[model samples]
Target chain A: MFGRIFHLLVKEFLQMKRDKSARFRLLVPPVIQMLLFGYAATFEVFNVSTAILDLDRSQESRALTDAFVHSSRFRIAVPAASERDVRDAVERSDVQVGIVIPAGFAELLKKGRTSPVQALVDGTNSNTALIALGYVGQIAGSFGQDYARNLAERTGRALGRPMVSVGLEERYWYNPNLNSRWFFVPGVIGTLALITIVNLTAFAIVREREVGTLEQILVTPLRPVEFIIGKTLPFFLIGLLEVSIVAGFGMAWFHVPFRGNPLVLLLGTCLFLLAALAIGLLISTVCTTQQQAFSSNFFVLNPMFILSGFSFPIPSMPQALQWLTYADPLRYYLVIIRATFLKGVGLDALWPQMLALAAIALGLLTVAVLRFRKSLD
Target chain B: MAGAIVEATGLSKRFGAVMAVDGLSFAVQPGEIFGLVGPDGAGKTTTMRMLAGVMRSDDGSITVDGIDVRAHPEQAKRHVSYMPQRFGLYEDLTVEENIRFYADLFEVPRRLWEERAAAMLTASNMTPFRKRLAGQLSGGMKQKLGLTCSLVHTPRVLLLDEPTTGVDPLSRREFWQILYSLRGEGVAMVISTAYLDEAERCDRLALLHDGRMVHCDTPAGLKAKMPGAMIEVAAAEPRRVRDAVQKLPGVAGVLLIGIGAHIHVDDAGRRLPEIAAALSAAGIATTEIGEVAPSIEDLFVALLENERNAA
Candidate 1:
């Protein structure tokens, strides 16, 4: 059985080496997707276009405008002469954020009177809008704090220290600075492996059936179990290699840290790949053509990806979708990988996820084996 | 049957409402080339697949080299090599690579495959193209490669389903020569084909119609089973000759050939002169008229026509 599977591995590798499209597909897309997701598919909202309208034209208002311009989060895309201009920039989506300062804003501040500034944000993409609003809040609050400190110094009552409002001291652990690339690059590695490995294994078997090679192989002394092992083992190896390349690229290019035990990562990856390849095998068993296999892959992969918590948190999903995610191998894999990459946790902390992944892999592999028959019928 | 290397008894396979192979029974001895001669949809492929242990029969059983196929197909598969009509060759792999893959699949030892592959490729005239990709090979070379792969393990029983259906005449002849050479090594071969002329090359064949075995015998034996002598008559207007001769006594049927017709008569000695006279009487100038030995095609047509008329 080992010999047969080894020969099959050799054959599969040779085919992969000779077929230009397969070679390209196996090597190029992961790198491209790593770059795309690492840079583009990010949660960090940067360079948000802001339109500013300072009605007071005072030092206080100009200072606030300068703060918005100097901060990396907001780029002053338009200088508004009137509220109409700020509203137009916000409405046309030319600027994602708009700030309008009222008249006497600096006078009210000098007199220690209450002052208010109106901020407008486009909520079409509520996530980006919310993140941008948070940045705006931070800049405005710091500016107010500075003014309060100056007022205390002038009055000589609080000894040049600003009066404290409710204060927030925030520290982001694991990923300091909340670098979204560091968070996303690891997830990209998992998602890319899932998509590409599933497709490779599914299409490989379906191509055999389509080209009439599967029937030829069945008549040999090689058993169905042997054939299934032989067919899938190569892809399992490829999945590991692919994950390594993508993970290495993520680490080197995106600086996503891999702080966990190498063995733990290897175990998680093997379990995940087994589950993914088993899904591919199951799809191959049900489909008669490459088109059917491809569509079926899309049907399964989309839900798996959505429920995997690659981008969206599992708890944030609907109740039924959350339950559905329990069955997604990618969900467990994502947890294991993220915990491994970010928290540097080993099996003690990740055992439940590892167990869930192992169960899923075993269950899917069992079903796939049951479905695959050594007969054309 | 006792000495047969491959035996199938009362095999029946149904696809939906169609009985693709109904009550099909046959046995092939060692060193024999058994042909499943049929038209399209005649269950030749189904029967071949069943015998090769790659398909299950709805009824009956098959044995390869005394191993029960359905009960233990994998064990039976150890001794049988099946090459389907469309033998899947990995287009990206070279011819040598394909042979090695199958050799490995069958668990042929490295030394054994090296020797067997060298001989097989040389015999098939494919040695020069060993390193060429299978996708680059012509239709005939692809078929030859498929055959070589199928035979790499030197299987006890070889099943080929329409191996030469689309191959050129020369390649088809060459393929049969390879099969004949295999016969000397005591390999039981079951080959199916829609080409009737090729059926004559088999040692014996089972003639199938609508998934049932209508007749099973050697090619000459099948021709001998024809109820009457075949009288071949050539004329400019063969249809006119057929019209006149088919109406005469002892005439069973008329089958048109190129510019002639094979007239089936109960007694060719009596009907030959009468057919000639009738064509002359009808003003259809005859090129030739004589009793001719029936071919497997003639026998098949006569048998099918007889069954249709009987039905």
Candidate 2:
């Protein structure tokens, strides 16, 4: 059995090596995609175009507008003379945000009363809008705190008692700077590995069936289990190699840290590869043609990708969908990989995810093996 | 029957509403080449697939080399090498690589395959092309490579389904030479072919029609059993000759061949002069008219026609 599987692996690799498209697919696309996703699949908002309408022509209003200009997050691309201009800027998407300083005229600050600043936002792309709003809130919040502190210091000198003020201190864990690259680079490893392994595994078998080699092999003395092992083992190794390439590129190019033990990541990868290869094998058994396999890959991988929490947070998904994510190997793999890359956690901390991944992998492999019959039904 | 290497009894396979192979019974002896001759969709492939143990028979049983195919198909597969109509050779791999892969699949030892591969390649005149990728080889060479791959392990029973259907005549003859050599070594072979000329080369032939075996015999026996004599009429337009004589009395059928027509009649001597006279009167010119030995196709058509008339 070992000898047969070894020969099968050799044959598979030879075929892969000789076929130009397969060679290209095995190496080039993952790196290109890693670079693309590293930059494109990001949540960190920066240089958000802003329109400023200062109705209050006072020192305090100008200071607030200056604060927006100074901050790296917002760029004062449009300076509005009136509310209509701000509205037009936001409505036409000329600016992602519009800041209107109402006609309070520094009186509220002098009297120690609260002032309301209206932030007009374009909510078409809700995620960008929400993040931009957060930046706006932070800038306005710091300005308010500075003003309150000045007022407290002046009032305390007159009253002979210090005023108490509340302040919030925010610190992000794992990702010290909350760099989105650190978060997304690890997810890119999982996503790219999944797509590459699944496609290679599925196409490997579908190509055989289409070419009629599968029927020829079945008549040989080679057992079904042996053939299955032979056919899938090379792909399993390819999956591992692909993960390493993508992971290594992520670390070197994006500087995505790998904090966990290497052994733990290897184990997690093996389990993940098992699940992915099984899914591909299952698709191959169901499909009689490569075109069917291609379409089926989309049908299967798209849902798994969405539910894997790679880009979208699983908890934020619909309740049923969140439950559905429990069955996706990518979901558990993403957790384990992200934890390893960013948190530097090992088996003890990620045991639950590791176990879930192992269970899903074994379950899928069992089903795939059972579904893959030596006989043509 | 005692030493029959492959025995299939009352085998039946159904596909939805179609009985692809119904009540098929045959035995193949060692060193014999058995042919399944039929038109398209005649269950020859279905029968071969069943005997190879790659497909399950809905009824009956097949025993290949003392192993019950249904009971232990994997075990039965050990002794059988099935080559489908489209012999699946990995096109990207070279000729020697393809053979080595199959040898490994059949668990043939390295030393044994090294020798076997060399011999098989030489036999097919593919020794020089061993390094050439299978896809780059001609269609005929691809079929030879497929055969070489299938024979790497020296299987006891070889099941080939229309192996030479699309091959050139020269290649087809070379392929038969390979089969005859294998037969010399006592390999029981079951080969299916649509070409009747190829069928004539087999030791025995089973004529399949509508998923049933209507006749089984040697080529000479089958032609000798033909009820009517066949007369060949060499004409400029065989189609017109066929149309002119098709409805004549005592005429069973008229098959149009290249540059001539084979007229199946009750008695060739009696009908020959009459056919010639009728054609001359119909303003059709005939170059020659005489009795000719009936081919497997003639016997097959006559048999089917008899059954149709009886039904």
Candidate 3:
């Protein structure tokens, strides 16, 4: 059985090597996708155009406007002549956010009265809006605090306890810069490997069936288990190789940090790939045609990617979907990848996710083997 | 040589409402080419699959080299190599690679691999093209290579389903030569073919129709079982002669053979004058009328038509 599986592996690899197009497919697309998506699939919101309407035209309002212009997150638009001008700029998408300061805005701060500053924000593309709003809120709050301190000192009165005592200092651990690329590049490593390995493995058995080669092998003495292993081992190795190369490129080209142990990454990658390849084998077992397999891939991959918390945070998803995501191996893999890439987390911190991945891989492989045996029978 | 290497008794198979092979019984001896001859959907392929232990039979039993096919398909499969209608060879792999793949699957020892492979390749005239990709080969060469791959492990029994269906005449002949050589070496072979001419080459043949065996015998015996004599009638207008004579009494079946028509009739000595008279009255002048020995094609057609009429 070992000799037979070894022979099948050799044949599969030789065939892949001889086909020039297949060889190119093995190495090229994943690299291109890794680089392209690393740059493209980022979440950092920058250069957002903002329009300011300051009715007061005073030092305090101007200082707040200056802060918006100086920050990397927003580009300053022409100062609006009126509230109507702010509306026009926002309506035309000339500005994503409009800051409308009231007529007594500077006078109110001098009197230590609460000023209601109306900041109109576009809610489309919610993630960008959310981040931009946070930045806007911080600038406004700090401006108020600075004004309050200046007023207290200039009054020559004993500074009593202030009304607003709530102050927050939010610290982002690991990714202190909040670089979205750092989060995306590592996730892309798992994603690229999953797509390539699943796609290739899905076609392995189905292609043989379509070309009439699988039936020829069935009459031989080789068992189904041996065939499954022989067919999957090379692809399993290729999946891991893809992970190392893409992860390396991510680190070198994109400067995405790899702070975790290399061995943990390897272990997590293998477990994730084993589950992915097993899902592909499951698709192959049920599909009789290559077209059916290709269509089924979309069904499997789209849900897996969307629910994986790769780009979208799992915590924010609906409760039902969050529960559903727990069943997806990619969800656990993303946890391992993102944590290991940014947090420098070791196995002790990541054991639960890793264990979930191992369990999923085992279940998927067992189901695939059972389905394949049924297909043969 | 060896006693019956493959014995299938009272075999039956069904697909939904259709009975593909029903109540079929046959045995193949060592060193013999047993042909399962049938038309499309006649259950030749299905029966071959059951005998090879890849397909389950709805009823009855199949044994290959003394191993019950249903009970131990792997063990039964080890003793046989079944080349399905489309002989599956990896198009990208070289001919040599395709042959060695099967050898490895069968776990043929490295020491015996060269000797076993060389014999098949040389017999099939594929030795010179060993390096050629299977996709690049001509249809005939691919078929020959498919056979070589199937024989890599030196199986005792071979079940080939239409292995030579679409090959060129020369390749078909060469393929048969390889099978004949294997037969000489005490290999029992069960081959299925739609071509009646190829059926004549088998040591014994079982004619199947609608999942039931209508007749089973040696090629000559099948021909001899034709219930009546066959008369090859020719005239100026062949279609007119065929139309006129087909209506005559005692005529069982009429089929076109080349430009002439071969008519099956009961007691040709008695029906010969009546056929001549009928064609004469239709303004078709008969040039020849005589009893000819039935070929395998003629016997198959006549038997199938008889079954249709009885049904």
Candidate 4:
């Protein structure tokens, strides 16, 4: 059985190597996506366009405007004299955020009285808008404090250094800069591997049936388990190659930190791939042609991608869907990859997910192998 | 010289409302080439599948080389090799690679395959094209490669389903030559084909029609069982003469052969003159009429007529 499986694996590898375009597709997509989404797929708001409405052309308002312009996070895209103009700019998406200073804004601050500055923001994309809102709040709160301190210095009032104060000193572990790229790159490694390995293995067995080669293989003494191994081992190695290249690219080009052990990463990746390949093999067993296999792959990958928590958080999903994610190998692998890629955690921190992924893989592969063997009979 | 390599008795199968194969029984001796002759939908494939142990028979006993296929299929499969009409060849894999895969599947050692594959490739005239992808090969070469793949382990019994259906004439000849060589190697073979000429090459064949055996005999034996002598009437207006001749007293059947009609009579020596006179009376003048040896085609046409008339 071992000898036959070895032979089958050799033939599978030879075929994979010969189909140049297929080979290119298998290895290239993960790396390209790692680079593309590494830079392009980001949630960290930078260089946000801000529209300013300066109804009061005073030093207080001008200083606030200067602060918005000076900060790297906010760039003043437009300066308007009227509130309507600021609203229009935001509505037209010309600016991601808008700030409005009222007519008596400086008088109220000098009297140490209540003053409100209106902030307008585009909320179409909630994440970017939320991040922009945070930057704006920080800038405006500091300006208010400075205004209060300046007024007290001139008037020599008792209100000095403000009465009430709450300080927030936030520290982001692993990614100190809170770079979204670091978070996304590892997820891409898992997601890309899932999509490619599933597609290739899903369509492969059906294509054999279509081309009339599988019937030949079935007649041989090679057991169904051996046949599955022969087919899976080559693609499993390909998936590993893809993960290493993408993970390495993410670290080298995108500069996502890799604080975890390579061995743990590989083990998690292999376990994940085994389940993915089994899903593909199960799909092939159910489908008769390549078209059916492809559509089935699409149906499978879409749900797996959604539930895996690759892009979406499992906890944020509905209670039912969150429960459903436990069955998805990608969900566990996403956690494993993120920990390995960014958090710099070891097996102690990740073994639960690794064990879960292994259990899922064994369950799926058991079903796939049984279905395959039954189909042959 | 050797006990039967295969013994199939009372095999039966049904697919929904259709009885695909009914009560098929045959025994093949060592080194014998047995052909199952049939047209489309003739249960040839269904029987082959049962013998290959991929499809189960509803009721039957099949033993390949003394192992019961029904009782223990996997063990039986060790000694049998089946090549379906679409003898599944991996189109993307090269010819040599495909062969290597089968060799591995059967666990033919690396050293043995290297030497055996060289000989097989040369016999199939595929030595120069071993590196070509199976999809790129001509239909005949692909079939030959499929056969070679099945033969890698030197199976005791080889079952091929319509091995030459789409092959060119020359390649068909080359393929048969290889099969003949395997027979020399003492492989019991069962082949199915619609072509009567290919049937003639088999030592014995079973004619399957409508899920039942219509005739089972050697090619000549079946022709000899033709209820009457066949009178080949060479002439124009063959169909016109067929209508007139079929109505004659001793005429059993008539099959159109090009511009002629082969009319089977209870006794052609006595019926030839009557057939000639009848054609003349009907004003459908025949050029010449004489008794001729019946072929497999004749046997099929006669057997079909016999079944329909009985029904």
Kindly report which residue pairs in candidate 1 clash with one another.
Answer: none
The predictions' CA RMSDs to the true structure, in order, are 4.0, 3.1, 3.4, 4.1
Ranking under TM-score, best-scoring first? Answer: 2, 3, 1, 4
lDDT of 4 by residue, B211-280 (tens): 8998888888888777878889999998898888888898888899986999988987789889888888
In Å, candidate 1's interface RMSD is: 1.1
Can you write out model 1's per-residue Cα lDDT over A1-377, one digit (the tens) per residue? 78877888789778777778877888898999899888898788889999999999998899988998899999989978999999999999999999999999998888776679889999999999999999988999889888888888888854435575777899899988888888888888899999988998899889899998888888887778888888888889889999999899889988788899989999999999999999999999988899999999999999899889988998888898999999999999988889899999999999999999999999999988888873257
Model 3 alpha-carbon miss at residue B14, Å: 3.5
Residue range with the least summed lDDT across 10 consecutive positions in model 2 chain B = B302-311
Ranked by DockQ from best down, the candidates are 2, 1, 3, 4
On a 0 to 1 TM-score scale, where does candidate 2 land against the true structure? 0.91
Error of 4 at A118 (Å): 4.3
C-alpha local distance difference test of each model: 0.88, 0.88, 0.86, 0.86
Docking class of 3: medium
Q: What's each prediction's TM-score?
A: 0.88, 0.91, 0.89, 0.86
On TM-score, the stronger of 2 and 3 is: 2
Report the error of model 3 at residue A67, Å.
Answer: 3.8
Best by TM-score: 2
